[model samples]
Target: MAHRLLLRRFVSVTLRGSSGPVRSRSSALFPSRSSLSWHGTGPPLHHQAVPATARGFCVSHASRVTFNVQNQADFAERVINSKKPVLVDFHAEWCAPCRILGPRLEKMVAKQQGKVIMAKVDIDEHTDLAIEYKVSVVPTVIAVKAGEVVAKFVGVKTEDDLEVFIKKLTCT
Candidate 1:
């Protein structure tokens, strides 16, 4: 019991920097991998859209697995109920378009960290949530602000599109 409590405390503290304090969760229920799960050790502030700088750019999460948000309900709570902006990518492993868009999205993640909670959802695994959002296509990206869907796209989107929308988005 004490170990569980300590673990929860550590996870909560570390997670708060990006996703916020960890709430109740079964150990196995939590995903071991997530690009967004890193705290201040968070991904650098360089845009994948920009030229690789010595300090800002190292490598993208291209070869590594994309974010795994399976079964973790509280995870999205920080996103949907955010004090900033929330962006979600609904994708499938089988879609070639999703594959092409994956690196683009990951690049955005590196740049948008403190400003936005960049999240990804594997529609193949989390069907119900996808249905709720009415995401009918792979690589559907949605931006949420103040717990409401503010911007949406049904196919692959460019970083410029996201940047322009974000420039117009309000975060107060």
Candidate 2:
């Protein structure tokens, strides 16, 4: 069957080096080329030093300042127990003010450069967390430090206001 042939070809291509650069029909369908590569029938190229051009493909989460909260457990672990101050943004997808405020918060937090972190919580998806945190309105941002709520704000705030909030949070 065609499936068997395709599987064999994929396995052979993956396990052994091809004559030259091999482009599969599947890879042609996608905008980006395959990231996987093998060399000279030796071990996969992962063992070798990744080229400078390929460094962009790597993801380093340590540099990330903002992330989504998955559940109550995630909230407790990442926000409550965090060593650095965390700005928990409670929002909903359809909320217009939340949409406007989210990016501004992210930009402000990114400027902190690891001094602060932002945890985005979709109220609709995590209703329990929203209720527990007493988030009665969309675009509620709470600053938590040392497992306690330090400051909170409701609705959209200007970039200057956000910068002031971030500066105040980081200063303490």
Candidate 3:
């Protein structure tokens, strides 16, 4: 009906200057239509890489704020040697407090964008890491900068407290 016509017009306007017969309203929106290859069925397939400018807008920071430590080597490489300050969260799946703190800490860290990153380490899976860090508690958060421990805390903290802790770490 009327909605379908409006959608068709919108598509034509947005896809102007494409390799296909359809003409778009603005060629600047998509500079390289050659990257896209049309097949007989379904949507067009992308055969080549698209330049960043042609890809439209994108976020500069890393989208993921939290990651799990696979092993000792992973912790050494990702957390110990990270350029930005890292908040190492040593936790256990069975611990209720650990479960609560993990998500809150991730939310706070994500708010900081890429200023700080979070490393999740399961105490049960990686006992060696917990022993090395002298973490007897189930939920422990240690802030490391330049391969050194800057600050640490144990037990679950309030959301406001977690935000303050993250802010302090990012500030330094």
Candidate 4:
């Protein structure tokens, strides 16, 4: 019981991030006074109206294995020359189909574990890659093996279809 109490105390202290004295049980259960004041009175000192960066990049989850190709060199090193089969998704931020297919494709690729990997290339950021691959359309998924493109498809595909495609790629 004492250990549990201490554990809870540590959690509360860490979560609250306040150096002041601890609050009563009833008060601690609800929102802290500072949080409520900031919410009611508008932006806090540390709060920002807009993100500092022009665009926010999605960080890969710990369990996920994905790569973002930043340039021609990165694409060559990570995708073309990769030992494992690679799925390159040529996408753009403004494209609706790309947005829809990106996450679905990622989930499908994750199921393959180490057998295959997914690489994302933003067409807007890397025009050279899109032109080199002859990718006129968004969400163009290309399967590369041994530094060569083995399979290519455009538009969104169902999870089932993607699974079938990946299985075929890995089988060979």
Q: Can you give the lDDT of residue 87 in candidate 3?
A: 94
Please provide, for model 1 over 71-146, each residue's C-alpha lDDT reduced to its tens digit, 9 standing for 90 to 100. 5475466566677776678889999998887677667655654566666788888888799899898889887788
TM-score of 4: 0.66
lDDT of each: 0.64, 0.79, 0.78, 0.80
> Stretches of candidate 3 above 4 Å error?
1-63
Give per-residue CA lDDT, model 2, range 40-150, as digits (tens).
563344443222121122344434878899888999999999999999999999999999999888888887778999999999999998999899999999999999999
Q: What is the C-alpha RMSD of each candidate to the true structure, in Å?
A: 17.0, 9.4, 11.4, 11.2
How would you encode candidate 4's per-residue C-alpha lDDT over 22-115 as one tens digit per residue? 4443334554654564554543544322211222334555135688897899999989889999999999999999999998988888888778
Lowest summed lDDT window (length 10), candidate 4: 48-57
Better lDDT candidate (2, 3): 2
Residues 37-140 of candidate 3 have per-residue lDDT tens digits of: 34444234333323212233345343476789999999999999999999999998899999899888888888887789999999899999999999998799
Per-model TM-score on C-alpha atoms: 0.56, 0.70, 0.64, 0.66
Question: How many Å off is the CA of 42 in candidate 3?
Answer: 23
Instruction: Give the candidate order by descending TM-score.
Output: 2, 4, 3, 1
lDDT computed for candidate 1? 0.64
Task: List runs of model 2 lying over 4 Å from the truth.
Answer: 1-17, 24-63
